[model samples]
Target: MSAIFNFQSLLIVILLLTCSCAYIQSLAPSLLDRNKIGLLGIFWKCAGIGE
Candidate 1:
């Protein structure tokens, strides 16, 4: 039961992320362009979500 629930939850997350990325990319493409920050800026990257 736990395994099945986990699989279903993961699938839902995958679908949501797919839709979110597509919508975000089309709406404001600049928001996703954080690669320039490099590995050291991962903390700040996550903080951006709050904004």
Candidate 2:
């Protein structure tokens, strides 16, 4: 039960993170490009959206 709850929370966190990253990418491509951010860049690249 506790494990399930933790998993759900982790999943929600990941979803939120992904959505926020997408929003940021849409809003500020230059910032993300210039800084070469790590996790978000990896996520977008894996999603086949980013370079």
Candidate 3:
């Protein structure tokens, strides 16, 4: 049980890091307004509206 819990915790941490990295990557100013668009895209995806 403890091992399973530890694995879940690690997975959660990894997921959080991945999402944060995606968000940060989408914040690039030189992307020519792509960041804001990507932000909306992320929201839609999270909401299951897209993809």
**Residue-level lDDT tens digits of model 2 in 1-51:** 553479887777666667766677788766556545676466555223422
TM-score against truth, every candidate: 0.51, 0.58, 0.45
Using TM-score as the yardstick, the better of models 2 and 3 is 2
User: What C-alpha lDDT values do all the predictions have?
Assistant: 0.56, 0.59, 0.49
Better of 1 and 2 by lDDT: 2
On residues 1-51, what C-alpha lDDT tens digit does candidate 3 reach at each position? Answer: 453469887777656655664565566424323434655555434322211
Minimal lDDT window, size 10, model 2 = 42-51
Could you tell me how far off, in angstroms, the CA of residue 1 lies in candidate 1 after the best superposition? 9.0
Q: Pick by TM-score: which candidate is best?
A: 2
lDDT of 1 by residue, 15-45 (tens): 6656666566567756666543877344334
User: In model 3, what is the error at residue 14, expressed in angstroms?
Assistant: 0.3
* Backbone collisions counted per model: 0, 0, 0
* Candidate 1 clash pair list: none
- In candidate 2, residue 46 scores what lDDT? 28
